[model samples]
Target chain A: MAQIRCTDLTLAYDGVTVADGIDFTVNAGDYLCIVGENGSGKSTLVRALLGLKAPTSGSITFGDGLTAKEIGYLPQQTEIQRDFPASVREVVLSGCIGRFGHSLFYTKLQKDLAAYHMERMGIADLAKKCYRELSGGQQQRVRLARALCATGKLLLLDEPTAGLDPIVSRELYSLIEHLHKTEKITVVMVSHDLEAVMHDASHILHLKKKQLFFGTREEYLDSEIGKTFLGGAGNA
Target chain B: MLEMVFEMFTYPFMLRALGVGVLVSLCAALLGVSLVLKRYSMIGDGLSHVGFGALAIAAVANLSPLKVAIPIVVIAAFFLLRLSENSRLKGDSAIAVISTSALALGVLVISVGGGVNTDLNSYMFGSIYAMSGEDVTLSLILSAVVLFLFLLFYTRIFAVTFDESFARASGVRVGLYNMLIAALTAVTIVLGMRMMGAMLISALIIFPALTSMRVFKTFRGVVISSAAVAVICFVVGITLSYLLDAPGGASVVLTNLAAMLLFSLIGMVRKS
Candidate 1:
């Protein structure tokens, strides 16, 4: 079943339309990578899908018992945000706030879930360490653990490997690949890593300022636009 | 020295001032962790200037300053939050524009209302015995309100302060919590300016949070440490001021400065 569907979606800012007439459907357990050039509205579309902003027009529908609020998100980090004063454990546990509902406390299950995700991300040893003191790769892992605690159904990552070394990026990708395959969590990622993501993603969303591409990986590879963009080898 | 301090508290007004000071300091610390984390700590300073302007207006209109300043500064806090998020006017620039203007407006209002009055100096710089019975009652009630809301939304506030966009993406009502912080801090700012004066109120908010963050690695730890630090500084500052004949507001701010310096030294030494 489709986990999320966007129909004729239009996103704009300050009365200027960025992307319009967009249609895409992400199926259950599918890893979808949203790719685009710098100015291409990938971030805007993510914001719309996450309900952070109202679509200029059109709608996004969710299925498979998934709601917008239940979707986990790992946002791109800024320098100031990176320097925030918080422990790795506290950062991960905060992801439970959405499910915390009206209660002012974290349940044992929530704490256990946070602990589980931290262990899964291999950062359980750094749980008590300050988040700001971690390396970029370690910080991203902590953020991933935090997002995992937010929801188990769907995880949306925005440029998760933006500022890491190539080796660390590959390691992070492997971790994400493991999560996608083993945890069966539907993944929607906006990333600039064309070659790295294609091998892992089940579907590709190639967005241009005026064009939109959404299909299975093979179909996307076979498409003329993909051929032209990738010069016939998306692996490159 | 201890007996001298005990004897000063024997007076009803001194006890009243101490009670209100303690309440305001605790509330400021609770609100401060988020404000400092959000980099909105100066909002207290900005709102206090607005409160100062409102206080002058209240005096001119012959109304209670607390009644007048509370609503005005609360509204100003909302505006400040909106302005802070506005791209063209973000962070300290927005605060500088609003706060300096309000400060000038305060002076103008005071002059236009016929020069500096007898209580104006007390309001601007704070006096230990300046808190009246009515002011004490309002302080207790408003402090309770601020403390209760802070506790009620502690987790949500933590989420919002840490990463606003991510928190919003995960279904936390980011705007509502921002407003809650602004409102609570506004009330605390107004109460604090009356008890510790405008110039020192921001110190109460920023110092405790910064000092706590120096020692604590987690949000909850910082918050608990901030409250403790704020109360201790306030008490120690008050005692020192009484003993040495110093200004109460400056005394508290200096104590906060000392605490920040001490904690930063410890942090550096530990890191090394």
Candidate 2:
């Protein structure tokens, strides 16, 4: 069953059209990579799917016992967030804010979840370290841990490897691949790297201003839209 | 020195000033951590200028200044937030535009309606001597409300201050908490304007957070230490002004600055 379905979605910023007539379905346990060029509204589409922004006119329906609030999101980090003064523990623990409901403080259960995710991310030792002091790879891992504490069922990452070196990017992809294959967390990601787009992605949703293509990785690699992005190397 | 300290609080005005000063300082410091983190620290300055304008109009119209200023400043804070959200202006630029224009309007109100009065001195540059018994009562009630709301929303505030987008996606109502912070800050700044003065009140909001940030590595640590530092500085500043016949607002600002410098030195030593 589809976990999330978008129909006839159009996104705009201040009346300037961003993307129009976009449709996609994220099936349960599917690894969907949203690939697009710069200014092609991949991030915007991510925002709309996460319910952070309302599409100009369309519906984002959640099914399979899933809700928008239950989705774990690793947002693209901004400069202010990068330099924020928070400890690794605090950052990860806050992912349980939604679970707290009206409670003023975190419960022991939430703390344990945060700790578990920290261990999973290999940053358990750095729980007390300030987030701003961590390296880029460490920070992204910390963020992934935080997102996991939100929901270990479905994870959404936006440009998780935007600034990392090739080695670190590969490591992050491997970590994500482990989560997808071993833990069975459905993964939806927005990334700029067309080269890294094929690996582990069950499906790809390539977005542009007017055209959007969503299909299996194999189908995408065979299509002209994917050829345009993946280039001739898609065959190799 | 102990007797002199005891003597200062014996007077009703000094007692009111100490009570209100400490209360406002604590609120300002608590909110300041988030404000500084969000890079919206200067919003306090902008709102105080608006408070000054409202006070001037209240004086001319013969209304209670606190009553008049609080709502206007709160609305301005909300307006500024809206402006930043919808308009192209950033928080700092919106603050600059609103604060300067309000300050100019305040000057206009004072000059056109009634030439500089003794009241203007106390309002523009605050005086502990100017705090009335009525002001003390209002400050007491408002301070309690601010403290209550802050503690109640502590978790939400911490989350939003760290990463608003993540918090929002996590189902935290970022807008509601942001408004609560803005309104609380507006009230704190207005009340503080009576003791810290319109010109210097933002210093109350800025100093403690910056000082604590220099020494503390975590948000909770910074918040707790900032509040402690604000209260201590306000008390010392009040006492110093009373003893030295100094302007109360300037005295408090200087005390905060000294504490900030001390924290900076400690931070340097630790790093070295």
Q: Which has the greatest lDDT? A: 2
Q: Best candidate, DockQ-wise? A: 2
> Compared with the true structure, what per-residue lDDT tens digits does model 1 show for residues B131-174?
88887887799888987888877778878888888889888889
In terms of docking quality, model 1 is medium
* Tens digit per residue, CA lDDT, model 1, A1-236: 68999988888999899988789899889999998888899989989989987988889999999999989999998655676888999899999988976788888999999999999999999999999989999999999999999888999999999999999999999999999999899999999877888889999988876446888889988988877877745556
Query: All candidates' TM-scores?
Result: 0.96, 0.96
- lDDT per residue for candidate 2 within B1-272, as digits (tens), equals 78888899788889889998998899899989898888787778889999999989888877888889989999999988776556434756877888999988988888788853537777889878778887778778877897888788887898999988899998888998889899999998988897788999999899999999888888788889999999999999999998888999999999999999999999999989
Name the runs in model 2 displaced over 4 angstroms. A232-236, B87-91, B115-118
Cα shift from native, residue B195, model 1 (Å): 2.6
Q: Name the candidate that leads on TM-score.
A: 2
Q: lDDT per model, in order?
A: 0.87, 0.87
